[model samples]
Target chain A: MNCRVLLAQIEPTLGNLSANLEMHLAAIADARARGVQMVLFPELSLSGYFLRDQVAEAALPAGHAILSQLCERSRDVSIGAGFVERGEDGRLYNSYGFFEDGRLLEVHRKVHLVTYGMFDDARDFAPGDRFRCVQSRHGRFGVLICEDMWHVSAAYLHFISNVDALLVPSASPGRGVTQTEEPGLHSVRTWNRMQEALALLFQSWIVYVNRVGSEDGMIFSGGSRVVDPFGRVAAELALLDPGVVETTLSADATRRARVMTPLRRDEKPWLVQRELTRILGQLEE
Target chain B: MNRLDIQCELVEQLLVRFLRSEAGKFGFLRAVVGVSGGVDSAVTAALCARAYGPDNVLGVRLPYKTSSPASEADALAVVQQLGIRTRRIEISAMADGYLAPNEVADRIRRGNVMARARMIVLYDLSAEWRALVIGTSNKTEILLGYSTQFGDAACALNPLGDLYKHQIFQLARHLGLPASVIEKTPTADLFEGQTDEGELGFTYAQADALFERMIDQRCGEEQLVAEGFEREFVRRIAARVALNQYKRLPPVIAKLSERTVNHDFRYLRSWGH
Candidate 1:
């Protein structure tokens, strides 16, 4: 399957849901006119990142009217957007809603919440307990939030689950100086390297979208990119600028890359499981 | 351009845009800066001139009676180079009125009085000129709490608060500042013959390197020492940074209600505007 995808790099206003939803709608309409079949937005794009104690107020149910409208309008273009999801248990989650054919297809909550410098996601969100690839009209793909793909296990699981593409939404801050003599973006360079490595390792397309603009002193470097199965950057947006990057992805390329590399092939899941059990048995003894 | 040059250009552009946007948000298109014939003030004056045209920036030189004549000449050079308006006010009487009456002999107390006197003049000029007072303190000085509270630290908006001292020199050179100004020893000019490094007991280059490792790189003291920094110097710098935490923050308010100023009731500087 060959499909055109768009990474929407947007600057979201903190704690402004209607304004952000309008931005998303405008981006979707613009992407649709450009013949994009799939549109991916950054993590927490609906409510903006760094909400602190305001996360609860920004949380929306999966069946919110704005999300429903997005799903209803996604008949021709499938849309994947991040929002603060108010779980049924009254907890909040950083979730991505995948919509297609006038229906909400999959809701993937971010499993790994960052709790380091300038981040307090773990304090405000309940981590999702599971990870699974969802089948879409285009192909089977997996969705991961920022920091989730940093773990090798997450990438390995996604590859073993046979995902054609991995969509990652991030709100990474810009830091450090660039090495090159040119005016290159450092955070963007680091992110591109990581995404390319993951794409090459998994032999699957990787779409990474990040938010832009400064929010209360933190500058989000919006260098959204699309990496092909062969680890080549198909398309990239500029840093610290709100824009969209459209690129065509070929599922056949993933198939060919997997065959050429064969890193995913000749796998022994049962043997690894047996060895894990024997190690556990020995530890028990 | 090299990486440092590129970074300098990027930062200059960003700071210019930021200053303009921030000033516009506050319904002001004019900026007032206190130029002390130092690189930090020179860079701030240049940025302000670029942000709000040279015609809109006013450089005020508040000097004391004992201030060096070279300081005044250097400040005048910046005014002529940038083609911005300037005013010179002698504040020796204003500072001495408080100091001389008490027969103050303490150097720090006299310095603090002079610093506050300069700020008083700047704020008055800001009101008269209808311009926001731009800050000149760099990140190294801010981190070290080398600034006098409510004096050199007071500003409507600070463009150089994030740039380290060494970076300020680079930016000044990039902005085509006069060599005399950039090469001069950085001093608060609080007293004659008082240099910043002499007071701090360390050069800005050394402090900047240690700051890069400890603050930016998040290296511990042991790691910094192992990385070739003197342990005593590292410990002293760390202690200074820790002890000066109060200087970097706003006055701690007792939370007596559900909301208090700078607490739950906090808002952006341009919240209403």
Candidate 2:
């Protein structure tokens, strides 16, 4: 039961909704051409990242005409990307949208609103309070945004669920690799190490896609990658361009790995409930 | 929505235009930047590279004896990942030879000396490479006067002058910079264990958000608190942004003429020609 996925590191122009959508469409078409069943893109791929107050006004319904066209265009591929979704209550959520078979499958709003380091997710958009797995012909998948993955308290719960793979749509900033003269080179290596460690610890396939190019003064390094259940990097795309790297997930391998390491047995569902309660309480306040 | 889109598109379009226009006037195709393995410099370098080209982007890693190897590695990593040429110059001897003092005094002066030394190296490279020196100071740091005025702050062009710390992060992610560099806490690396967040007494997230609400939205204290913000945090941030406003503007000068340098009417250097 091997499933192929594509990590599309597409360059997005901030706030150019039409252009960004076109880029995603091209990437989705390419993913289908490459026989990728699922393709992941960065957070806010539709409207771009850090859009200020404009995020509120830019919010669109999942059933919008343009989105419908995108779903129709990407009918063959399971496309996951970030966008500003307008919820029923009219509150905008930083959402991960799933499109498959010419239909909108699901929309998972980011729960942890990152209020730090240039992110005002809490200020403009409301946090998502639900976590549910999307059942697909390929496998059960859990989707999260950039900060949602880093929120270990929430990620641990998502990992403990019956999901076969984890997909992250991110718009992460670039830092200096070390402390030196290589302005273009990354001096830091902790984040990459963390991704590998997380994949190994969770024993689930991971797909991470990021945006490239500068907006305002921020730089996003597009080191989009796919990690196997064995925690090995299956494919890695370059930084600063629109790139696509496709690879398959062996359903047999994932099942075998989960069985051999059945660490979920030790995971306490009660603890997750308690943690979610606390997090929810804080958000409500 | 259209206005916002137009503004965003204009920011990039005009930025490219301005950088090219400036370069055309100077006859330099590339730029040299000193990335401290921090977000600001990393973003600045990315912009210069995008505005020019990776081949035209030269990064200089100037490290003092006390500087961490991680800083040097991070700098080199960015250069390699971004596909830019680089030069690593150790400034220990330069600092030691220029400043002759007791150990304590030597240490105190070393930080400033190191900064000046790094600028010297950058200027030298800018000349040799026939490139412009790109500045990395953001609006927040510049507003707070948190940067060394003439050292790391000296540059031919600063693409990030209008952005705050948080905005820089947003743009950084959009640029697809190196991930390792994107996640670390920013620091001056002037001394060991000196983090920008810790010294600033506020996280960039909090500071930048507060700036937006207060300055951009023109919200009052009551509205800010009603929005679920902490009272003390708002007070501190309000004070910080207000006090730092002066740093974000040009140095004041006496209006000696009807057309003063920066006050009445202004023109580019081309006006003099």
Candidate 3:
């Protein structure tokens, strides 16, 4: 189950589908040359983030020609990337696609659309309805968009669903200063802390990829990284610079972490389900 | 260096890189900045010099008839230290061409005319020199709406828009700006003996400290008062910030369709690239 993954920290051209697709193809080729099994891109990698009405024009169907070309190009390496998807219901969704072996494996619509300061995703996109872990040739992994991993429940659902690794694609803007007086301390540190907690608690590997470069005055910090089950940073890219970070993950580490921690062994899904049902019933009454 | 100094250095590097990338993105290898001998413009000129190289940066000094001679000397001092190319343009005739016949006596009205006149000279020179016009407005002035619209506020890009006035002084000192420019009383210098603090009725240091507490720290009025800020001062500053909110944003348009310009029809600057 050991595999090498490359995190592509790219500066996407907003609403330029062809240009973004070309960047993705180049990164995929680079990953393949490095013998990487999988490459992960940041959120909305195809159309860039912070697109208001341009999201409609940038929306692609699951079988769109560009996606087909990406899937075709993914024959040598698996590609995990995000894009705006136009559903059959005519609603647009912030979506992630997993492509492998010249085929589209899975598409996960982002569940939580951020609507806070500087974000208007809720106004632009329809929220995803469900969450599920997808199986890959390397291992079983779960996908989470930027704000999804912020909530403890999202990671808990993935952990209970038995995912070996959690992949998070984000477009978080860099803010605040680091303890060492570096920029992007606030947003980058928060992301790292959340990923580490989830990895250590779930005894699973975590891969977090964020975009870089400024778009319309908003700077996206590109501190893409991978955390092992021991909450250790395996590999990381530079902050605010577009680059690639490739790291090899050991499957045995997860097994050893689970054995040592034993946090997941004493789980009780039935009790949790019963409690949730009771709480919902009480709230309804 | 202390924490602020360390942060200032990091920001300086970031801004230098940002200016270079932004200028190159817009197909310009050079920059044009209007240096007023004030801290804001001096720091901006220094940054442009660092970003585009002193040879590529054009520091323009546009002085009206009543502008202080000392202001021009300080601006020249900056140009000399940075070793950048400079142009001295007298704006008095241009501003008076329209203002004289109308007999405009209002100080505010005349000040705006001079500001707009300076912008006109900078923009025309920008076209001739093939350089982007970098802005000199600081966060304190922008927040207080102390700038005249479409005048000194106009720019192709602004590196100093995010830094407050006091922070601008810190950066100016760090960039080796002339002590005279950094230590002088802040002024738009629109008229003889005119100062920014005299016009605004509040010192920039006071406004900056209050802004850091109220806006950045999210402190309430009561909290601010508890922290030793005068109640009346906090109230007045809060009112000014609220009233001038429109100046900080793009012009508003009524939404009539599914997608409107700037409101819904948004795209990044890299779209054309």
Candidate 4:
């Protein structure tokens, strides 16, 4: 199926849940008015990133009124928004909720908690253990919350599952000033290359939405863009600015890319899995 | 290691945004800067002019008795170029008031006193004007602890902390600053004939090169030596960085309770703002 989608690149007020909720509601209204079928928000759209102790306060339970409010609004446009989820086991998780048809659909928890260099995600939230595909009215999709995209296996698992697109919610900090090259942040360039590679190899669309604004000294760089299955940027927003952008997903383009390359069709997962077991000494054990 | 060079046009946009956003978070739309006629302060003032129009930025020039006259004239040039409001307050009386009674004899003691007196004046005006103080200390000064604690280092926000000294000159030229500021040697203007390099016994370029290798590349002694840095010079620079570390952070609070201010009860200054 082919449909239009909107990326809401917003600057979240630190630790303010109700204010961020209002932001979500306003963006949803705007996207719905534009006839966009899906809306994606950046990681921790409800709770600002760099939440030292604020993670606990920002955690929402499954039956939370806020999530319910979003669910009701998603009847027309499917929504993907990031929040700290309070688990049934009482553990907190960095999770993205995909809602449609006036109900909460699949929720993808961030499996990799970044633990190096200005990141202590593991200290705040528990890790997610599995990668699951989300069935949407617009298209089949996968969710990767920021660091999940850094790991190849996370995107590959969804590729194996045959998703049409991967929605990545990122709150990455802006860093590294470009000197000899064009005027831009180095981190953003690195992110662009990774998205292109993942899109081309997996033969899937990459919808990357990053947030803007600063939390203390850390500035979240906003260069949200959608890459087509052929590894080309279809649309993008400006860097370090809060803005919304739109792009279209088409079945025809995906079909053309895959039909020409046939990389996925030629893939052998069972053989690879067996080899992985051998490499990991599982067969010997 | 990353290149020390910066895209000046890009940095100008980012610093402008940083000044506005960080200041706005605290309900401030006006900025106050202590313009010292140096490239660092001049570039900072230029960014401030762009962030909160010239009408909202107040450039205060605090001059001591021993300060170079050219310093004052060059500072005026910067203020005139940006069209920002300017104020000149002679700080000789304020500094001598304490120095006379305390008999502060050492040059280091007198310099520290003068630096801190300016800080007191800036913070007081920040309250009167209802504006935040924007700092001008760059990465080189901050990394080497070459600033006074709670003195020249005190500010509500610092957009230039991440930039190196070379980048400051790069930005100054990009801002179209007066040649007097961009080409002159940098000094704190605390005493007569005291330049930063002369006092530190080394050049800023040397320090920048050493740090780019030693800190950014995570190079050890052997690696640094292999990279052409003198082993003795590396040790001396590293010692300076380690010794001056206190000036770079907030006062360390002892943990007496389960949740302390900078310990378990950690949160950013702009947490709720």
Candidate with best DockQ: 4
Report the Cα lDDT for residue B154, model 2.
81
**DockQ per candidate:** 0.29, 0.04, 0.44, 0.70
Most lDDT-accurate candidate: 4
Model 1 CA deviation exceeding 4 Å by range = A178-185, A271-285, B1-6, B13-32, B48-59, B83-105, B118-134, B218-228, B255-273
The digit string of per-residue lDDT tens for model 1 on B1-273 reads 322223777677667756875677557999999998989999999999998999999999988988888888999999889999999998999988989989998989888888899999999988998889999998899999999999989998888887788789889998998999999998888888999999999999889888878887799978988999999999899999999999888899999998888877634453322
The TM-score values for the models, in the order shown, are: 0.88, 0.56, 0.94, 0.98
Each prediction's whole-model lDDT (CA):
0.86, 0.74, 0.87, 0.91
Q: Which candidate is the best by TM-score?
A: 4
Docking class of 2: incorrect
lDDT of 4 by residue, B65-125 (tens): 8889999999999999999998999899999999999899899889899889999999999
What TM-score does each prediction get for chain A alone?
0.94, 0.89, 0.96, 0.98
Model 2 chain A poorest ten-residue lDDT run: A179-188
For model 1, the docking class works out as acceptable
The superposed Cα distance between candidate 4 and the true structure at residue B75, in angstroms, equals: 0.9
Model 1 interface RMSD over true interface Cα atoms: 4.5
Evaluate candidate 3 and give its CAPRI docking class based on DockQ: acceptable
Higher-TM-score candidate of 3 and 4: 4
